[model samples]
Target: MIVPSSLFASGTESWRGDGRTDEFDSVATASRALADGGVTAVTGAFGFDPSGTAALIAPERFARGTRSGASRPLPAVVSSALTPSDVHTDRIRRVLAAIDEGVVDKAVLARTLEMTFDGPLDPADVFARFLPGPDAATTTAFAVPLDPAPGRADHWLIGASPELLIAKTGRTVTCHPFAGTTPRGVDAESDRRAVAALRASDKDLREHAFVVEQIVDVLAPLCRELDVPDRPQIESTPAVWHLATPIRGVLTDESITALDLAALTSPTPAVCGTPRAAAARLIDEVEGSRDFYAGAVGWCDAAGDGRWMVSIRCLELDAAGTGVTTWAGGGIVAGSDPAAEVAETEAKFRTVLGALGVDPADLTDRSRPAPAPTST
Candidate 1:
């Protein structure tokens, strides 16, 4: 697990062995484990669907350190996307229709790309490639081992995420949600223009407001005092620029753990959509199971202090270690352009594809018209 301030690596045995069973109350289970005094911290990942299974663990041993820049070259690989670009864009159009119909104000849609390596890929090495500098206060890189399906090899979820789902410390609660996005420009001048354009775009601003408003509504009842900026600021990563709003609150009930806050506020408009249930239903009909793609990952201590980062800019490695599936998504609103949305997901994919020595440009051909939508 990794946060901007620290990196933690854990091994040995989990307090209750593999904790990835079908639908259980993970937050409640962790609370009980912490209350029992068997472990100081509970770490792992929560799936995208709140009711879905989670891969949580109470580690027996763990080490903490600062972030590192170490990395190794990835081997040769073949890549394919699970969802075709045309199909994904067509889905975006469908979401636009939903927004027009007032089904939801906004929704996040994602696509996945799978890569198979020529040899076994080392999780540690791939993770190393994902780590950011210690000064990268806006980024979090993580590598969490997941429970394998019966008869399958060990699997892992790994990525460098730029959005914080939630963090808690003492009576303090914080969430930094990222919404509207634009690809980084090719030159310094173009980049500056891109930032300026993003800050002023009405469409982007509307998209961002949906995320901030939803988060504030969820957190308001739980906190005695909450601070939300009047406007979002530009948050830059190597691949894209995002409009981010940092929200902080003082909890009225210190008993509320980070996991609880996460459960309440996650799948925010940044990852899900406004009127979450309506958007989620639309997503399920189109994208099927998200697995853990847009889920949250982190550790919460017995003191109810911990951090969770949105599971974007991430990939899942199969048991054999050769197959990898990474996902990227964008929020869709009434003004969203289908072509631009497709490009946005592409820009998001660059965070991982570039690291793996893959040229993202070669992955999609835009000259041809996107094909009509079909069942997956």
Candidate 2:
């Protein structure tokens, strides 16, 4: 179930599933469910591949609100072990080769870490470490039930994502897509310099622009009035800083729900790459599969008004929550450096690593210096 920190105190019920809902039919179906005055949680996989899933689930019960604090600190030994493929720079070289061959202008490359903790694991505990009593407002923290069907192991998808895939409230809609990134510094001066470098870097700016342009192009036809900033603003999470642009518009057709917008704009250039189809093919050959890591996760109300965020900075826990797999990736454009990309994935891993009670340095130690910490 997706439990947003702010809504945790509001007695909001939630649900989850490993299935697909018709993007075209979901809004109307959800509107019917909401006619009775209850909200439903919609969880989707990154859905880059044809077999990915999505669902609109009803909450079984919404317990009275309570303030559950962070979980106990896990032992340091319960850290994620890097795999040979986790720091593999060769995959990036291949992606760059595709860029050189003009197969795609930009493609996002990702890596994974496998974590097995001692003793039983709790999804709430992991969530608490990342969210921390609702004070961590920079990012939206969530936990979605992974398997709601009977005869299945209980599972949940949890994460704290900084990007908003789509938001709908009546006729107005908003999207915040992040593209370029840089690691935050340990001090004020260093942090400022990191932000400046991201803004000034031609490569980063170009990457960021591609994402903004992609979102604008898709949304323009559906909106009566659209607004996009000329430049991106800096948005931060405890993990990294992003070059973000906030786009807003009044939907020309109120019939288009948030879910429809998500289907239309997902696997965006920010997460996929320019010329989405070609990038997806390359990602498949290189990264294999991404279950829900880059997918959309959030709740949609009965009225079809809801919020969904890109699935990043997250972990896919086993049904029992014992084994955890998390992903981190970066965009590859012309002039990209393979070694630097490896470092970028390492930096992105820090958010989930810290949440899981593992030291970031331990993971970073295995790779080349992590590119100052940027996120997908």
- lDDT per prediction? 0.77, 0.69
The reply for model 2, stretches above 4 Å from the true place, is: 1-46, 49-51, 60-67, 75-79, 83-87, 132-138, 148-152, 361-376
Which residue segments of model 1 deviate by more than 4 Å? Answer: 1-25, 66-71, 148-153, 361-376
Worst 10 residues of 1 by lDDT: 9-18
When summed lDDT is taken over every stretch of 10 residues in candidate 2, the lowest stretch is 5-14
Per-residue CA lDDT of candidate 1, range 1-376, in tens? Answer: 4222123322211112123222123556666676666676767677787556566666654445434445566777754545677788878888889889999998899887877777778766777787775556678777777662222236778888888989999999999999999999999999999999999989999999999998999999999999999999999989899999999999999988887788788788898988988888888776666777898887787788888888898888888888988888999998888898888888898989876777755553334432233432
Q: Give the Cα-based TM-score of candidate 1 against the true structure.
A: 0.88
Q: Report the Cα lDDT for residue 375, model 2.
A: 19
lDDT of 2 by residue, 238-287 (tens): 66788999999999888666766776788888889989888887887777
Which structure among the candidates has the greatest TM-score?
1
Query: At residue 208, what lDDT does model 2 achieve?
Result: 92
